[model samples]
Target: MTISGSCFCGAVTYKIEGKLRDARSCHCSMCRKAFSAQASAYALVEQSEFRWLSGEKLLTNYESKHGAGLQFCSKCGSTLCGTYKGMIHGVTLGCVDGNPDIALDRHIFVGSKALWETVPEGVPQYEELPPENA
Candidate 1:
């Protein structure tokens, strides 16, 4: 399935030609701050299936000390995707156009989630990074 996405100002756009995977919600302080929300909803995509359709030069990226990177549209400050070692690692669900066929498989860093934010019941929750990621 082909999925398309763009930044809030429409200055940046991307497309994913394959299915998304490892969908998850991250409630870590870093994530909450990055997304400016209770948590960040994301889905992974293979580099081979991901491509920037336009406004590549208008994107800015910030890399965490842990080596994870979040790329945003410089024009609108819209988070678009995550990167690892310079390759696309995942797409931020918020910027995804329409509805993509995916759901949160896990919630990570709940231990650091906002005190007022309550994770819903069901699925799986991790105090920190999941074992597979830790």
Candidate 2:
């Protein structure tokens, strides 16, 4: 299925051409700080399958520590999505056009989650990272 999404100011839009790989919430400090929210939820999309449909120039990028990059809209400063090491791409769940038929599979970096937060029910939670190394 093809999924579409846009930034908060509608300055950037994109489309993904297949089912996502893994959909989950991330509670890592970087995610929290980047989003300024309790957590961030995203779905993985292959670099080749993801396409920028509009406003390419409006997309701005930030390189956080460890060389990880977060992509957002320059106009509204909305945290639209991100790419890791310039390879795989992921889109924030909130930016998707409608409800994606997916569920939060796990919580990553639970060890770095805010002290006041509690893990949501039913999802497998990981202390530092996903089980897979790469």
Candidate 3:
């Protein structure tokens, strides 16, 4: 299955060629500030299976002091994706075109979550990134 998405102004578009998995919500302070939301939802995709169909030139990347870099549409300022020191890309689900046929498996960085934010019940919560085996 393939999942597709674009920025608010449709300037940037992307396609995920394979199945998406390990979806999660991040309540980290950096995420909240970067996304301008209480939390950010994302799904993991292999770099080989992901493609930027358009607007590659319009993507502007910002690397925080913590070494976390995010890519967003320069025209619309929409958060598109993020990359760590790995081959996987974390695609923000909010910009996705449709239902990704996945569910949030866990909540990460809850320890740094906003005081006013309340995470949903029944979902696994972690004070930081999940264990490698999780």
Candidate 4:
């Protein structure tokens, strides 16, 4: 299956081929700040299956730290996606155009979660990153 998405102003667009992994909500402080929400939802896609469909030049990359960077649309400042070590590509759930046939898998970085925010019921919650097998 192919799933497409774009930034708020349509300045940046992307296409993901094949199946997307189950989504996860991240409660890390950086994620909260980047998304301006209690958490950020994302689905990981294999590097080879992800492609920039348009506005590649309008996408500005902010390297938050070593080996990781967030890509957003320069025109509207929409957080489009992120790259980790240039391997796995993480697509923001909000920017997706339609259903991506995926479900929430778990929540991570709960230790940094906002005090007023409560995790959704029944979803697995982890203080930090989940185990490799999770």
> In lDDT terms, which candidate is top?
1
Q: What digit string (tens of lDDT, one per residue) describes model 1 on residues 63-117?
A: 9877899999998999999998777899999899998999999999999999999
Expressed as tens digits, the lDDT of each residue in 1-134 for candidate 4 is: 99999999887889988878869999999899988999999988888998988999998777755676788889999998878765547899899989999998999999899999999889998999898735
User: What digit string (tens of lDDT, one per residue) describes model 2 on residues 1-134?
Assistant: 88889988888998888877688888988899998987899988888888889988987888866777888888998877777775547889999988667778888888889999988878888888776943
Model 1 lDDT, residue 47, Cα: 92
TM-score attained by model 2: 0.93
Put the candidates in lDDT order, highest first.
Answer: 1, 3, 4, 2
Q: Which 10-residue window in model 3 sums to the lowest lDDT?
A: 81-90
Q: Which residue pairs clash within candidate 4?
A: none
- What's the C-alpha lDDT at position 33 in model 3? 91
- Each prediction's number of clashing residue pairs: 0, 0, 0, 0
Q: What is the lDDT of candidate 2?
A: 0.84
Please give the distance, in angstroms, between residue 128's alpha carbon in candidate 2 and its true position after superposition. Answer: 0.6
Predicted structure with the largest TM-score when compared to the true one: 1
> Which of the two, 2 or 4, has more lDDT?
4
